[model samples]
Target: MEPKPATPLLNKETPIIQSKPNKKDFLNHLEAYLAKRDGVDKLLKISRYAAKIVLTSSALPETLTLTHRLMSFESSVGVSRKAFRLGKFVQDVNALRSSHFDSTEDVFLSIVAYGGEGVYFFVEQFVWLVKSGLIDKKHARRLGLMSAWAEFVGYLGSVSLKMRDLNRIKEEEKRVKMSIEVAITRGIKCEEEKERLGKLIEKKLMKRFSVVQDLADALMAVADIRDGKGHFLGPLSVSIAGLLSALISTHKNWVSC
Candidate 1:
């Protein structure tokens, strides 16, 4: 038609070349990952419990020497991770100072959770010092017991708070669903509202995973509080719980990173 624009001189289409990640990109990503304190701590935690699991498993051969090495590695990692928490309790205090709650129950639970955690972390420094051989080992058991109890209380408060928040989220989700149904029934165009509600629901669902992590940590705390002498919780059970907690924490940290 109409002389076809005088014929193109050359092909105008350009080839698309996909760039792959190189060694420099990988090193940059690894550096970013290790830069976050929580990310590194969670990785170490995962490694520690994974080692414990392998050490306790019967399927491994020459486990005596392996177990000893694993135990040493695990212990060292545990102590090192505590060093990351030197001023961690200040975060809890700051949170408490900055937050405003809707009810007295929320305030009480927040205090219990954050306060208990603060105490636990504060006590943990001494325990860490003991483990590091700066303090006498004789105080280790008492300090450790206190830390475990505080951690258990913190977890209890955390679980309660999360349950309350979950209930509220569920109620909100129900309201949103009903609204969506009504809107659809009335032939209303609310695509933006529906999308917002969907994202809210997704966020709430992701938050529910934290409860599982908390429960697993609570189990480990119970084991620590009892010095691993509980009937239902043996070395294997504790190791499994620790691993579960570590994996959940690692997932959270990785996603945030």
Candidate 2:
């Protein structure tokens, strides 16, 4: 046999490793981290708080409606009228906290044991209501029809099923988050997930939100002008609605949530 060719002392290597960001992998890792931080486990306490606040506020909006309907019912006896009107609504408000207890999220169970900041809750009340099939499916379907983001989450895994269906929720949540990030980077326009074999989890589960789509559009504009995440340029038409809004809203809710 001919003598083996002499091997080069050093292997030729490419600097492609440093070429550009592997956004896919980078984002995957980021998603995993955010999921952990935003998880049912780490944020159960926050989730319950968020659930309570949202539930109460949502019901609070119906005060006038409750008063009108009750007067029509003629059950205004011994009812302080205003207080009575608000009382029933208050009870309904409590349902917000009561609904979130003993829930779960895919691999984890909620910390809330029964309608509170307990040890068995994970998802929120509205989500729980949706999960327990206690809400109006038709209304939810209507909400879904408002936008594609709304549709996928309607009458299905939404907040309603997210309690018992943990894995599906996480996968869906991640996809929406990523897509929102995409919209944020795309020429200043608003924007807009899944899974089977863990691989498919990235496809079938995520459901984008209309609110997020609007935010992404704004973020994209910001990035375009500044060439970065939070920078800005020109007259900066940005307001308390886009990234600023998301930041403020999440900040307010997160602290309280």
Candidate 3:
């Protein structure tokens, strides 16, 4: 009995091994799970809505042209072919979203600043000005406004056609409408501030163009134009440019911090 007890493996240590999952296998499982939850479709739908809102709010000619192209392409193709094209379109829009996010360095800011009605109007006008050969793109691009606007247009124009997406557009419009008013109010305060802004606009921006009153009137018009449903792009553009320029000029020193 003592000899049998001595044979017991008392010194033996058992190692606990953990199972390691391969990254590719994990991804495959995750994708399968997402497919089961309809997450991919939902995400794509949301993307479509986001893209539509950005495009509609910005109202850039290039974006509009792209939208028309997509529409024409859809109308011209068969159902199966259209689905393929739409997938490609979504990919292109997502790429644009990535580029825009890269430029802003923040998704929230990119969506808000570029997607908001105020900035949209500004970019739309700027693009128009650029297209008409009225304003130089160099300064605007150097200011980083052009890049933001470009991404906004590109992403928005890539949106697919869906009924729910249209409803989302309306919701987005409301959000943009409220945001613009709030931002403008916050940006420019009392009469002194307004007057100061006006003077600066006249000095810096107006000096370059013959359409001083158009610009000034547009700047003032944003205060009264409350609805996103209305045709306020012309005026909204001036307001945004003024606000953005003032903000940049005032806060440019923050970069050193």
Top candidate (lDDT): 1
Across 161-239, the per-residue lDDT of candidate 2 in tens digits comes to 3334445557665665455445444534432111122333322232233234334434433443344435443223332
Cα lDDT computed for each candidate against the true fold: 0.79, 0.34, 0.38
**Taking the tens digit of each residue's C-alpha lDDT, what string does model 1 give over 14-110?**
1112222244565676777789887788888888888877877764676468667777898898899888778788988998899789999999999
Model 3, runs deviating above 4 Å: 1-26, 62-64, 70-257
Between prediction 2 and prediction 3, which has the larger lDDT? 3
lDDT of residue 113 for candidate 2: 16
lDDT of 2 at 49: 31
| Tens digit per residue, CA lDDT, model 3, 1-257 | 45433222212241112223245565665555455323333333334433444444556566457877644443333122213222233433443366533333345443443354234434445444454457786654432354344434433332211122344445554554444345444553334333433344333332233133223323333423432235544434534443443333223222111
User: Ten consecutive residues with minimal summed lDDT in candidate 3?
Assistant: 8-17
Give candidate 3's error at residue 26 in angstroms.
4.6
Index of the highest-TM-score prediction:
1
The TM-score values for the models, in the order shown, are 0.84, 0.16, 0.19
How much does each candidate deviate from the true structure in C-alpha RMSD?
A: 11.2, 21.4, 26.7
Alpha carbon deviation, residue 34, candidate 3 (Å):
4.1
- Of candidates 3 and 2, the better by TM-score: 3
